[model samples]
Target: MIQVRIKPGVEDRIRGFFPWVYRPEIISYSKQPKKGDLVVVRDYSGRFLGYGYINPSTNISIRIVSFNKEEPIGEELIRKRLKDALDYRKRLSLDSNAYRLVHSEGDFLPGLIVDVYGEYAVVEFTTYGMRSFKDWVVKALVELLKPKGIYERVSDYVATIEGVEDKGGILYGDVPEEVTIWEHDLKFLVLVPRGQKTGFFLDQRRARRLIRNFVKPGDECLDLFCHTGGFALNMKRAGAKKVTAVDLSEEALKVGKKNASLNQMSDVEWLEANAFDFLRKMHAEGRRFDLVVIDPPSFAKNKASVPSALRGYKELFFRGLHVTKPGGYLVVYSCSFHIRREHLLQTLLEASKDVKRQVRIVGESIQDLDHPWMLQTPNTLYLKGIYAEVL
Candidate 1:
């Protein structure tokens, strides 16, 4: 087996059960190995630590597969990890047919994510190590769940960072051009074969349910950054007076309208525009709504950008508050791990003060139970949401 030695004093992180080994922490290696090679990791004192997959091209040089020295990284191990992930979902009993089954390191399976939509599963390989096990993992998933289809949604950065050249597509059974999924009794047509991040943002599943309950009958609702109209459809189903879904992707808007039609929901509007621009325009035009949902993609990918991301959040929320009627509901959410709960709360507070509006928190939520978080790894819990009333 290839040997990887950590620099002096750097073993504490591994000893504490942290999964990643950065390149700067490495002392030496017995041999230069190909990407995704299984290697034995040790401390500077030659003490055995764990086993992990190595990718020299990335700063995250190693991702620990097993801490036990005797444990092997094989088919059985993959089966066990996959089983654990599935069991967690079963326990949660999420009503939505579409949800995240595996959440990378959160599931103890680094660099891999699996989103399930009914009988179809979309897997994303985000590292060289996971990409190497693509076939085995897919086969294991097939043997276990026997889904009707399995597809791949590869991140372009995965190839650049991990030295993984392959961009993902169907690696197994046929994946339909569009897969129908259920969210709160509403039908949504997801373009899995060519859509964003496993075809939907399953992380926001529970939050959407909250929106459904909070939105009263005949209430005008606005879903910003509404990819494929998940929130809009749910609001319409909950008897909203009108639902307008806005997204930059014309393709997504087309599908969003189709999804509304699929569920036999009328009075739903679709707009293709930049969310930030649209919000500013709405504020200037004095457009007000009974309820607004702001679910933006991650603006903070790294620690350095977190402050700016929070500023962006504040601006968005402030604009949202400006356009919402007094006592109206606002559902704000952030998927960036770097944006902590306190930071989000602070941003909302600042936005409220800026708009001179009194805001009361009605509800707060984190990632669903299926996305388990290790005790020490708070970063794994990335989803944070708040339901506030502007008064």
Candidate 2:
């Protein structure tokens, strides 16, 4: 394996188990590294740091997989990691058959994501290094879980960034377009091939369940970015009178309608429109909801977009606050790791000041236990929700 050494002062972070090594952090290399090259990382003094794969062109150059000098990166390590990830999921509450089985760095398998829907599984290789071990990952999943099928869903951005071909399709067995999965008592339709982020937002399982507590019988509720109506169905099941579900994707809303009908729920009003415009229009029309959930997609994909993301959040909060009835529940979520919890809180405070509406935080939630994040790698803990009572 190629040996790579980092600059001084970077050894401490590696010692602390921080997985990523930036491109600029390197001082010297044993040889010219190629994309997706397995290399041994070392400190400036030539002390062994960790074993990782090198992506020469990317900003995040090396994604460390094994910190142990003895435990090198190989197929055995991949198998062990997948086994551990599955074990962690088994310990979690099995209320939903659909859940995140491997959450990239959260499971210490950086660049790899695996989500299970019923008896089938979906895998995504976001980095060139992880894609090299696709065969091993698929074999491990089949041997461990014995799933009916395993599908590979690679994104266009990942392909371009990692310099890998978009090889997204059924890796093993047959995968259906749609699969029905249960969360608590409510059922949802997961679009495996075409849906967002591995078909469903499995990280928000706890948040969706927690939403039931704030909803009352005959309460008017609004679900923004209501992909497949996960929150909308839950609110209806909780006996909400009128639930308005809004999303930009007509395909998502179509599935949302199916999910609502799957649960025998017909009171939900599904709308295909941009959530921001819809919220502003509703607020202008004097529409007030007893419960409102603004769970938008990641507004910030990178650090550069954070400023605009915060502005978007502020505007959404301003509109969301005004549309929510007095003393009603308002839940705002940010799935972007770039937008920290403090950012969301600060945005909420600023929006409250601008809108002249005070809110008391009633609840807080992060990614589900199945999607465990390490303290060293905060990016794994991407999803966060703040539940507040508007006053």
Candidate 3:
């Protein structure tokens, strides 16, 4: 293994079990490091830090897998990690048959994502280093879960940034274009090969169940960025009289329609348009909803874009507030790790002050148990939602 030493004062973070090592933080390498090579990361004084794989070309240079000096990165370690991830999932008795089998850093296997949709599993390798262990990951998934088929999904970031040529296909067995899965009495058609984030937003499984508590029969509801209508379907299932589901992706709305039909509840009004534009249009039209959910894609991909993301959130909240009926529920979610909970709260505060709408927070939710967030690595906790009642 190659020995890589970091600059001074950087070891404290590694000691706290922070997984990533930035490119510029390293002082010297024992030898010339390759793009995806197993490295023994060390302190400036040559003390052991952790064992991880290095991507010399990337900004996040090293992603540590094993913090214990004695436990190195090997086939055994890989198998153990996969087993740990599976065991954690088995413990959760969720109503959903589909869930995230492995959540990248959340599962302590950074750069690897596995989302299970019934008999099939979709695997994504986000980093060059984790890509090297693709065979091991597939074999372990087969041995443990014994899924009928395994499909490889290549993200654009992996293709562009990591430069992996494989355009994603069936790695093992046969994976169909669409797979039907159920979540808490609601059935959905998951586009394993083509759908967003392994067919459905499995991270919002908890939110789907929780939103039922706020919904009432004959209540008008709005689901923004309604990818495959996860929340909209849930809202309808909970007996909402009218539900408006909006999204830019016609493909997503198509599947969402199928999902609504699959559940035998086809009343969800699916609209194709940009969510931001739709929110403003609804406010302009004086259309008020009993419950409004603004669950948009990550506005900020990095820290530098956070300011712009906040401005975007402020506007969304302002419009969302106006569109929400007085004494109705308004839920906002931020999927970006860069956009912290405090940022969402502050934006909500500003939006409320500008709109003069008194609001009280009803509840909060994070990613489901299937998507575990490590305390040491704040980045693992990426999904957050705030449920508020407007007065």
Candidate 4:
């Protein structure tokens, strides 16, 4: 075992259960620290703090997985954590087979993500350290879930940053190219091998279900950045006479059309255009909808990108408001963790002031219950949607 000591004042935060230790906060190591080695963390005075895996090259150098000195990191501990996560989800009764099984730090299993879809599971390891426990993770999942197969989804950028191989494929059993899963009388075809964010945005299940309440029969609806038609299908199913789903990817539009056909909703209009351009076109054409959903991809990935990301969000808000009909509803979402709830609210306020339309907030929503967030790690609560009425 390797020993790691932190700087004088850094021990306070570690005692308070903050899981990350930045490289600058570390004072000394028992030896030259390896990139992905388990280490025993200690305070400046040589007091035990926690046990975690070390990534010496990154800014976030340490991610503590165990704070109890009695409980060491091993196969048994890993199995216990997996079983506990499964137990937690069983209690949620998410009403759908597709849900996040392991939410990284939310489950005290940093650097890993697991999403279940029907009889298959998709796993991702975001850190070089957690990659070492792949065998243990797979074995536990097989024993617990008894899924038909397990697939891996890896990000190229994360792989480069974490010094891991940038490869993705089936890790266990056999996975199909597509899987059909149902959610609240709705069935979605998940393209696990090539779809976005582990086949679907499972976190937005609540919002998809909630949007039905605000819709009226025969109302026109717009779903911008509508990847694979999650919101669009829901809007149409809610009795919207016409639904327009726009996305930049033609591939996604094809899938959306297929999804529409799957639900017998072939009437939905799939448009292959960038969301901003489509919004501008709608405004120019004097086209207005009863409900508009602005759910775009994360504009900011890290703290340094927050300012520019806020600017992008402000532009979307401005366009979304102008494109919405008077007395209609507008829903804007920011999936970036850096874009906090306050940031989204402030952006909406500024956009409203500029558009000269008084905005009335009707409802606010976060990621569904399946994606549990911890107060200690605000980043865990990444998805935020603001529903407002244009007065």
Q: Estimated TM-score per prediction? A: 0.96, 0.98, 0.98, 0.98
**lDDT of each candidate versus the true structure:** 0.87, 0.92, 0.92, 0.91
Cα lDDT of model 3 by residue, 1-391, tens digit: 9999999999999999899999999999999999889999999999999999999988899999999988898888888999998888889987888989888888889999999999999999999899999889888889988999999989887899987888989989989899999899888898999888667889999998999999989999999999999899889988999899999999999998888877888668999999889988888899999999999999999999999999999999999999999999999999999999999999999999999999999999999899998898888899999999999
Residue pairs clashing in model 1 are none
Q: Which ten residues in a row have the lowest lDDT in candidate 1?
A: 158-167
Off by over 4 Å in 1: none
Model 2, 1-391: lDDT tens digits are 8999999999999899999999999987889999989999999999899999999999999999999988998889999999999988888886999988898888899999999999999999999998989999999999998999999988888978887776699999999999999989988888899998799998899999999999999999999999999899999989999999999999999999998888888889999999989988998899999999999999999999999999999999999999989999889999999999999999999999988998999999998888889899998889999999999
Task: Provide the lDDT at 46 for model 3.
Answer: 94
RMSD of 1: 1.5
User: Can you write out model 4's per-residue Cα lDDT over 227-321, one digit (the tens) per residue?
Assistant: 99999999999999999999998888888889999999856999999888888888889888999999999999999999999999898899899
lDDT of 2 at 136: 93
| Alpha carbon deviation, residue 273, candidate 1 (Å) | 1.2
TM accuracy, model 1: 0.96
TM-score for candidate 2: 0.98
Task: Choose 1 or 2, whichever is better by lDDT.
Answer: 2
Model 4: how far residue 98 lies from native, Å: 0.5
Q: Better model by lDDT, 2 or 4?
A: 2
For candidate 4, give the lDDT of residue 381. Answer: 90
Evaluated at residue 123, the lDDT of candidate 2 is 96
